[model samples]
Target chain A: DTAVSQTPKYLVTQMGNDKSIKCEQNLGHDTMYWYKQDSKKFLKIMFSYNNKELIINETVPNRFSPKSPDKAHLNLHINSLELGDSAVYFCASSLSGNQETQYFGPGTRLLVL
Target chain B: QQQVKQSPQSLIVQKGGISIINCAYENTAFDYFPWYQQFPGKGPALLIAIRPDVSEKKEGRFTISFNKSAKQFSLHIMDSQPGDSATYFCAANYLGGKLIFGQGTELSVKP
Candidate 1:
């Protein structure tokens, strides 16, 4: 079984268009996170949720919003996407808020023109 | 204090050779350090990890050597095979906080 899964493996849209990426984990983890990997392969954490509650929010712009409906799912919605929004979005989950090991999903590639 | 610097943005090695990637951190608060391996079109996966309390940890041919005093850690792949070629990332976090990842090092193992 896929421990962590993400939807829309690829997305291509114009600037100002809104899009959403879905993520789900079946590892029975309590914490889930969203990360962005730029073209340079630099990975950065964007948001984190534990048991459906927001635990960490980085310096990301308001255009990027993360919603966790439960402990198993975390989704990212981007509004007014810009050219700079092009990157690979990844979802990860841990056993708990303090767990050290985090499993990552395949990732969703987004490109804005 | 939040950055993890990695060296040699890219590396090439012959089969059966050793591949090493080094990382340094400025934050003393970081206690958990991990190395992730990522193949093309895939997300990064945890390859190995270590804590400040341990100087070294090894699993199979992959080993992590950490130096708390120097705030540096390195991943050494022994007898590297072509299948081991991938982008490796070093990350650090304190008490389960957000992980600060290094820029990444792409390893290419020649057959």
Candidate 2:
């Protein structure tokens, strides 16, 4: 069984458009995170949410927003996307914050054209 | 500055050989270090981890060597196999929650 899952394996949108990526985890974890992997394969954390409450917010742009409806679901919404947003977005979850092992989804590859 | 720096952006190893990847962190407060492996089109999965209190931790064919004072860690894969080809990332957990990941290393095991 897949512990973590993400929708839209690939996304291609024009600039200034809006899109959303959904993630779900069945591991019964309380902390969820959004990460971005660039062309150089540099992985960086975008946001972290614990028990549906925002915890760590990186220096990401305001157009990128994360919404966690519950502990099992966390969605990312990007508004007015730009070419710079073209990268792979990964969704991860852990038991709670604090360096626990994180289970990651298959990831959503977003390409802003 | 890159908090966690990984060396060898890519690597090629022969089957049955050993593969090594190194990482260093700037934050001395980090206590938990983890290694993640990602195959093609897959998300990163936890492979092995170590704490500052221990110098080494071995799990099956994977081993992690940590140097707390130097803020450095390394992952060693023994008996490399074609199925083990993947990208490896080393990450340090600062103060518990936030994880700082190193630049990934793509390892290809040749059969």
Candidate 3:
């Protein structure tokens, strides 16, 4: 069984299209996060949710939104995707708000043409 | 400013040799430092981690050397193997639920 899992490991979409990536964690955790890894391999935090409540939202564009239906699931929706949106998106979960180890999913490579 | 800086963006080491990667951070508030290893087309997995209170920690052939005063940390792999080839990243974080990652370092273990 996978501790964290993401669907559509690879996604190729055209510009101005909308797409969503789903993530789920089998481990009982209270916090989840979304990170974007660019071509330069720089990983940055985009959003974090604690107990299904949005806690930390970085300077992400309005087109990108994260929804946590429950403590074990977090989904990211991107509207009108742009070429610069091409990157590897990773989902991670921690046991609590902080000071805990994080487990990451395989990742979703999104390519915007 | 780049919060965390990693040196030698890429490295090549002979199998059975030692592999070392260094990292430095600008934020003094970062009390926790972690190192992640990622394979191609895969997400990063936590290889090892250390806190400022400890000078160093070792697990098997992996070791983390932490310097609280210098705001620097490093990862050392003893008896590197071909299967150890991957990208390594150093990250720092405070009590917040966010982590600041350094540009990854690609390590190739030549057999």
Candidate 4:
């Protein structure tokens, strides 16, 4: 069974449109995170949720928002996507905030034209 | 600084050769160091990890050598194979802090 899973493996949309990505983990972890990877393959943390509570929100734009309905689910909603928003997004989960290892999902690729 | 610096943005190795990737960190509070392997179109998976207390940790063909005083660590792949071709990332984590990853090293094993 996949430990962490994200829906909409690939998305292509026009600029100024809205999109959302859903992430779910079955590892029974309390901490979940969202990360963005740019064209240069640089990964940066975007947001973090621990036990359905927002903890870390990096220097992301207001158009990007992460919502955690529960401990097992965390979704990202992007409003008015721009050309620069095209990149790969990853979702990960760990047992706790201090867990050494994080299980990652198969990333979602978004393209804005 | 909370950064993990990785060297050799890309590397090519023979099937039986040894591949080495290095990483350095400025944060002394980072207690755990892990190496993650990522294939194309897939997420990164933890391969091996080491703590600051240990100078070296070996698992099968993969080994991690750490230098606490220098705040540097490295990953060594012995007898690398074509199947080992992938991107490798080095990350640092404190006890209660988030993990910071290196730029990443893309390894291509030639058969």
- Provide i-RMS per model in Å: 1.3, 1.5, 1.5, 1.5
lDDT of each: 0.94, 0.91, 0.92, 0.93
Which prediction has the highest lDDT against the true structure?
Answer: 1
- The docking category that best describes candidate 2 is medium
Candidate 4 residue pairs in backbone clash: none
Considering every candidate listed, which one attains the maximal TM-score?
1
Across B25-95, the per-residue lDDT of candidate 2 in tens digits comes to 88777768999999988899999988889999999999999988887889999999999999999998875
Candidate 4 CAPRI grade: medium
Model 3: lDDT of residue A94: 93
Which candidate tops DockQ?
1
What is the lDDT for B80 in model 3?
Answer: 98
Which regions in candidate 4 have their CA more than 4 angstroms from the true location?
B94-97
Question: In candidate 2 chain B, where is summed lDDT lowest over 10 consecutive residues?
Answer: B92-101
What is each candidate's DockQ, to 2 decimals? 0.78, 0.75, 0.73, 0.67
Candidate 1, position A56, lDDT: 90
Q: Write the per-residue lDDT of candidate 3 for residues A1-96, one digit (tens) a residue.
A: 999999889999999999999999998988999999998888999998999999889999999999999999999999999999999999999977
Query: If you score just chain A, what TM-score does every candidate get?
Result: 0.97, 0.96, 0.97, 0.97
Native contacts retained, all candidates in order: 0.77, 0.77, 0.74, 0.56
Q: Each model's TM-score?
A: 0.98, 0.96, 0.97, 0.97
What is the RMSD of candidate 3? 1.1
Candidate 1's residue-wise lDDT over B1-111, tens digit each?
799999989999999999999999999988799899999999999999998999999999999999999989999999999999999999998558588999999999999
